[model samples]
Target: MLHFFKNLKIFAKILSLSTLLLLFVIIVAAYSLNQTVLLSDKLKSLSKEEIAFLGVANEVSTLQLEKNIYIERALRLILKRKFNESASFFDGSEPVVNKHNLQLIKKTTEGVQVGLAEIDKLVVNLLSKQWSAKIEKNIVNIREDFNKLKGEIVEFDAKVQAFFAASNISSELIEGEILQLERQQDTIDEHIISLMAGVERLTLDIIQESEQLESSAVKRTVIFTLVSVLVGTCLAFMIAKNIRVNLNKGISVAQQLSSGNLAVSFVANQQQDEVGQLLRELELMSQHFRKVLSKVTESSMHISQLASTLSNNTSDTAKDTEAQQSGIEQIASSITEMVSSIQEVSKNAHVAAESTQHADQQATEGHDIVSGVTESISTLVTSVENTSEVIKQLAKETANVESILDVIGSIAEQTNLLALNAAIEAARAGEQGKGFAVVADEVRSLALRTHESTQQIQTLIRNLQQQASNSVTKMDEGCTYAAETVQRATKAEASLKNIASAVNTINSMNMQIASAAEEQSSVAELINQSVEDISHKTQLNAERTHQISKESHDLSSLAETLQSAVKQFKTN
Candidate 1:
């Protein structure tokens, strides 16, 4: 996609970037709105769950109030020896208990769930022991439990009057004072009332929490909307401006390229986009133009100098002979200087060849040493792997030994039980069982010894297990280190091979240099002999010297004309 965008037109690039930014904004807004809707629905559902929880708490409170009332009536009836009525009222509590099965559990909080579970258990426990034939006796046994919260009979009477003042208990009361009954056993009524209050408080807390969370969600939604609008608008504007700025820069660089300003450095955006590609292409083109311009400038200067020198040297026929004589004398000295340079080149090539051969030798040695190290690491890795396997097997064997120890411990306990049974049987047989009793005692001692031995073995096995765990951890570390070392050594070997290949390439290039140097040296010797021969033949070319001088002037003039045309573009 990045490569494809690099070739896109500037207009298309701007459109794509704008579209992408707008799409991002749309996605962000949609997601924020989606989250808002989900949160709203969740809050609404929580409100419903809290209402349901409140209903359940109310049901529990109503059930507890009825139980306390019925228990009081039943106890009073028992006090009156009205057995039939007491039993009927005792049966009345069962329906209240059956109502507990309808738990309102949907979307309930943890606190609500726990409170309801506690209420269920408390109701079941209280119902089990509330009204029985030994109910008074049982209540008396747990009377000390209420001693901490113990109040006076007057206090109990006042609480009872207030309870009767409530509408539910007022209608359900038998025509007797229930204060005496509640005082007779205060703990049951107090515990049930506490549980009812707890359930009510928990439901209220959940409702309040839901309300606060809903408020927080509303605030977050508003803040997110404002922030998205602010950030999205700024980001879109900045991206559009950046594209336009870079496009202008690309146009300026192209204008510079067209104006023969090759010496001016090309400036463009460094982004991986179409404008950046255009800028980079302009930079490359400018560099090529600079190179051609530089060569043309040098050629122009050379041609101008050659033309002036040719025009001066070919002034007339007499001056041409003097010029030819001077040139022959200079060629002999130049040939001698070229011979000296060729010898120096041959010497340098020999030195380079020797250096490359030595480097190749060192590279080969490094390859061998790295290969050896890799092999050593590989061997160590194998040993570590085998040790790891052994350690794993040891761990398995220890587990099996521990299981066997458990079996032995169970067998020891059974043996001890059997020995005691045998001893009792022997004791019951009286005088004839005396010997058998002694044997039972011996067998009991044997079982005790076996139990003690199994314990010792278990302890030893535990120690062995700990040692095996430590050994396995160390072995794993060693295995990992060895594997890493093998990788490093392999990489070193590969690096050495690469170096060896590079050394061989250098050696081959050195050999070619030595060969080329030898060929140049031979050519230089031949050119030296030709220069000497040309100096001797200078007089024989005296008749043709005037024509040659005229031709040289014409050639120099043409070179200057060509050079001026090429020198128009700036190179620096």
Candidate 2:
């Protein structure tokens, strides 16, 4: 049974269990619903048919009693009227008494007929088939008896009406009519009792049938509910137990795998359930891990062997690298000394070039100084020539001033002759001539001073002209001297230019020598750098070889450790 459940899929297993429980629930619900429907039908019959039948029966019985009372009251009134020999038993009229009794009896009879009709309807619509036939028969009998009683009441009312209508009624006739009515009353009472008994009996039967149906329906519902509960409990326990057992097996297998036991065996049957599939996958995983571990073990052993061989090869290479490094160091030392000697030669050549440049600069400055002196001397000669021309112009301007002074002297002499003639004419005119003579005397004295002043001016002019002439001559001499000095300075400037040119030639040769020395220095430095680079590369190679040897030894150790770690996993 477990194997069958295990072979089912996970969904199918759960679905089967649920189906079983659901089936039980459906059966219980269906049965209970059916029972409830039966009970409900019985209750509906009791409420709508059986209970209505009983109510209608009770109403018929009451109406029958009312009819009998009305009939009896009518008979009593007729007896009273017969015994008392009165015309009416009530209201002072025999016809009125008879009509009142007939109206009451007819009303009660109509009510009884209506109740019987309702009872007949209840019996026709009865839900209980077993009671329908018997109840229908009882209602038919009741209707027949009620009909005969109604006929008797009508016949008695007619006779009473006829008796009351006769004005000359005999006592014996009255007695005979009364006796007949009494007999009819007895029959009516018997009919009423029979109708009531039949209705009561029908009511009792309906009650009993309803109670039986309710009891049976309750029993069926209880039994089915208990059966469903029991079946569902058993199914749930079975499905849960099956699943738990399989899951426990899967847990055991997982525990073993967790402990790193790759060699542990897992066996599974052809179960398609979830726990079964999980166990199968675990078994596959264990097998795959076993194969991987086997390969890793073999690879680790091979790695250890290769690491040992690498260590030996690196050691031999390290020895060769050390010897090569020593030879490179010796060659580097010789090249370094050669580079130092070339650097010293380059330094001395650079100093000589700088000294030559300084000498050329001094020679150029000396040439510039001689040229500046020559320009100054030429400038001075031009200034002296301009000053000599200015002095010659001053001498000519002084001669023109002397000629103007001579013209002023001649005008002064003409005024003196005019004043003398005025004085002589005043001597001839007496006192008037005396006044004219005084004015003439003052005029003559002014003209004489003017002539004397003109003579002094001509003399000063001559002195000025002579000084100007002397300055011209002195400036001419100074100009000649300046011209000679300028010639000497120009000759000196030419000599200095020749010296500067020779110094520049020597500076150019020195620059060429310096440039050649710099080229040689650069070439020697390049050779020295090549030697240093080779020495550095050789030293680096030796160091790297030693590092490789050490790393190879470490690699062998790591491979052995890896092999030991892999040994812990049992692959076979």
Candidate 3:
């Protein structure tokens, strides 16, 4: 019942402990009370029985004194020749002695009783011898054989009277009678002495009996007191130790939680008490949190992968755009050179026509100018074919870059999904997941940034493709202009000299477009490097999440242990 109370609610536990202490005190008090009653009874018995025993012993002593006084009186009477009076005194003292002897039998033990019996026998023998001696003495005093001598002796007796009775006897006869009387008196005195000795022996026996009784009583009381004290100390120690154990368990739990070491294991107590219930609930909560963190960690890893792919595609697209811009500038420079050759061709043709006086020489000069024009036109055709090859290469590279960007965008979308899952998990974990959630957010932001950079690279790639297409168109226009200049150099020389400045302006604009594309490619490379950094961080975050999951499992195990430990206490 006490165990049941101790495992109950807090208030009940305190009450139970207090009740146990009170009960212990009550038990000790009861033991003392019982001892007290027993001692009181023993004391009462001692007061009644022992006091009565002593009183009887004292009465015996008083009787012995009275008998001694009576014996003295009896001896005086015997000396006066009044034997009857002495016998009367002896008889009067006998009752007191007999009464004392009988009382010893009633109040005292075996040894005192034996002495009283011996005293009674001695008193009877002494009285019997006294009677016999008294008769003998009287016989000697009377004359029975001679009648005349009897009458004369009677007359002599009357003259001496009772005063001379002791002297009239012969010296030898009187001495003999006195000796016999003295022997009888000595026997009586010895009997009185033996009776007094018996009384003293009885008193000594009573005293020894009282001391033994007192010693026994003391021994019993002391033994009981010692047992009670031992029991009380054991009860107190057990109660104190029990409380200490429970308090220590509570402290251990608090310390483990504070350190973020959820993996602490202890025996979970089976009791359904308040503390047990609380610890059990905590274990369940930790388990749930651990599971949620696991899923979040998996999702974060998937997002990190997508972000990496996006960075790769954006960097590839930027390189291709930079290549296409390089090709357009080469084509523009070819167009400018072809135009300069046409101007020179027109100038030489005019010089040849001015020398009419020397027709043969002028015709020869025109032929040489025609040959130079044909060489210039051949170079222009070669430049146009090379620009067409460059445009085709730019188109192919642009298509590849676009495909890679599409893949990056798709991965970015998937990362967003994983980030969403991580956020949900972090929310469930509450305060514990706050730091993890921040990392997840960073991953999401990097994914978005990579996506945005890919989009910019795509736009730039598109612009480069457009510029490449325009350069092809310009190359075709340069072809037409080159053909027309060839025709005009054959037919006339004035038109070819007019177009050299336009070719110079187109070449300058192409160089500026290549420079801008190079700058854009550099920006894309920087974004790709940032994506790599973010990917590395994401990987680290995933690892940390796994660690957290493992810790959560440990916490769950600890909760189970705490539950088991708590079960040892009986709540029922």
For this target, which candidate reaches the highest TM-score against the unseen true structure? 2
Q: Which stretches of candidate 2 lie over 4 Å from their true place?
A: 1-4, 72-98, 127-204, 218-241, 248-252, 266-268, 294-562
Give the TM-score comparing model 3 with the true structure, all chains together.
0.25
Q: Which pairs of residues collide in candidate 2?
A: 426-433
Candidate that beats the other on TM-score, 2 or 3, i.e. the better one: 2
Instruction: Compose the digit string of candidate 3's lDDT tens values, residues 1-572.
Output: 66764467655656665776577667656766675675566455435533443454445345434433443343344444443333332334444643454344334333333434443443333234322333333222211211222233233224322322333344455445546544544453454344344434433444454455557656765775677567656755765665667767767776765555555565667655566666676666556655655555555555455545554554555455455545555554555565455545544444443333244444455566766887788788788878888897988899899999999998987897888789889999999999989988988898899889889989999998898888888888888888887776665333322232333344445445545555555555555555555555545554555455455455545545554543442222
Q: Score residue 260 of candidate 1 by CA lDDT.
A: 72
Worst 10 residues of 2 by lDDT: 123-132
- CA shift at 177, candidate 3, in angstroms? 10
lDDT of 2 by residue, 1-572 (tens): 76776688767977987897788778777876887787577556656654565677667667767766776777666666768777644445566656777888778767866875675566555433555566557656655665675576567557655655555455677678768867876776676567667656766666676677668877877887788778777877877887798889999888888888777777645778888889888989998888887888788888888878887888888788788878878887887787788778778777877887788888888888888888888888888888788888878888888888888999999999998888888889997678889999999999999999999999889889889988888988898888889888888878878887887887788778778878877887887788788878878887887888788788878878888887877666
Residue 42 C-alpha lDDT in model 1: 52
Off by over 4 Å in 1: 1-355, 382-386, 425-438, 478-487, 510-572
| Cα lDDT over the full model 2 | 0.76
Ranking of predictions according to lDDT: 2, 1, 3
